[model samples]
Target: MLPKGFQYAGVYAGLKDNGKKDMGVIVSERKAVCAGVTTTNLACAACVKRARKILRRGAAKAIIVNTKYANACTGKQGERDDAEYAKIAEKLFGGPVLTASTGVIGQNMPLDNIRRGAELLKKELRDDYDAFAEAILTTDLVVKKISKTVQILGRDVTVAGVAKGSGMIHPDMATMLAFITTDADIDRGLLQRIIREVTAISFNQITVDGDTSTNDMCLCLANGLSGVRIDRQALPIFQAALTEVLIYLAKAIAADGEGATKLMEVNVTGARSLKEARLAAKAVAGSPLVKCAVYGGDDNWGRVIAAVGRSGARFDPEKVRMNWDGLQSKTVTINIDLANGRESAQAWGCDLTEGYIKINTKYN
Candidate 1:
């Protein structure tokens, strides 16, 4: 419902034969405090590597992006696309620029279209969230946008976010490129803490597939357009709002997961520690074997249990437990109860199926 600020044009970048909107720009009207989280994949995309460096100063007024080709493995020239984008943003917006890209892997980036997209953006920048949403999606079945208005320093501030990932979405920093923008005045240190806290439980907690992307980037921009300062005192509120956006975007990504039909929430509990719990959960979430079982609706708890066992986390098999959509699957769940301790952790996830394979095949 964000009235779309930032005009957008989807001039067939030829990256996708479907002629979908691919290249786009989201520019804030003012300098905004920006916080971003990138993929931990050692072979990160050229765009992700550079976006992290650009957002370090906690400010970026414009974001340039493309979706047909992942700006990865392009060698030194790929590295150059990052700086080229910043330069593009500067030319169009007269401000600092941040860039992000996600699509086919190991393909050369489309720099000429990117440059043209920037020029098109300059001629048509507005407050239309729809245009922005359309521009960022690749293989997404629908447009994605999440926003919330909350009190910051006793003043109203808005946090709006959008993401695209119908595939390659195991976000240890999640495989999707998500950008969040807000109109709150926050310094870099506080912005970093809030973003870190928000992403930990939100983005880092979900997985459609075990595959993490090289181009995953989640960024938050706070331009103070709402006239509120998200000072340290108001950190908690800001964190909550940011977390809301992250969770929304993550779920949307999952719901739109390539060939995904039913979205799921797996909660892993009764672990000795949080880290152990997360490892166990991720193991279940990322397991294709477990996912296939879920896809078949076979009520398979052993796969879940097996995944947990292999997670390298400690837990008494007798003390571990499992549930499907909150109902205890007696024949399928694994539980190990601690004889004396009162600590445990839970994780979230979904099922996989042939439809997933079919979709990728069709899309390609």
Candidate 2:
């Protein structure tokens, strides 16, 4: 289900040879309070820069996205192309626009094709959520989306989101694009705070190939059409609902990791601080040896222990405890007791397999 007062469309404009949808647009009837978290990588895409600038103004009316040609490392031309696309979209949608692109880096975006795509998208505008989801995917095998309704201030508030990612994923923003929409009224500052906090526990706690991409980003738009004001008293409920939606999409991305057969959940407990817990959890999740062991269904607690030991988190080895109660299921959970403090954190990932190598190596 889509949030209120928004329209979506996805159309092909000669970007992909296979005729798959390569461009998508989401427009809100009213200017929406927007917040976004983007790739921390130094070689970020031009669209990332543009989006950040637009978001700093505090509101946006639409988001234009394209897949199959990340506008990264193309120098000034890439930046100009991004601006051009935004201009085209803003003119058509008649409001401020944010843009995002994903796919192979170091290539120039085909602006002419994208302009054509913008026209097609305008003509195709509808509530076709699935088409928008499909248009943002590169190597993902399935669509990742979620929707939930919560009662806030005696009003029904809806939160819906869509995401696309399969590989080149890691913490500090994975190689993915996610757009979250809501109808609850939230202040810009509060919305930004909630997005950052939720991302730390969700998108920032997942890994696929331990590589961050240049075009990764997660954006949230709140149009307040539901007439539900999320004041301080109602923040907790809204935050919980947002976190649930993001975590569901994040786990879905991990579970659908390229050629993965199992979803791996790493839990680090007894840490001295939240940072240490997150470090240990991410280390365990990104460890290739641990992932391979999980793939082969091996009870190799040693790999998990080794990952934690080198994670820069101080802990006594002898006092550490390991559990693998999830071995019998497709979802494997590895629990680590650091025996250092009371804090705990979790990270999600996927098992490594030979198929992963094949898919990446053969990818054009």
Q: What would the TM-scores of all predictions be?
A: 0.87, 0.96
Relative to the true structure, candidate 2 reaches a TM of 0.96
How many collisions between residues are there in candidate 2? 0
lDDT string for model 2 (184-233, tens) is 89999889988999999999999999888898899999999998899988
Q: What ranges in model 2 sit over 4 Å off?
A: 167-174
The per-model lDDT (C-alpha) reads 0.69, 0.87
Give the top-scoring candidate (TM-score).
2
lDDT of 1 by residue, 222-300 (tens): 7766667665677788788877888888777766677665555556665667777667666776778876776666657
- Stretches of model 1 off by over 4 angstroms after superposition: 1-14, 152-154, 168-175, 326-346, 361-364
Give the C-alpha miss distance for residue 212 in model 2, angstroms: 1.0
RMSD of each predicted structure: 4.1, 2.6
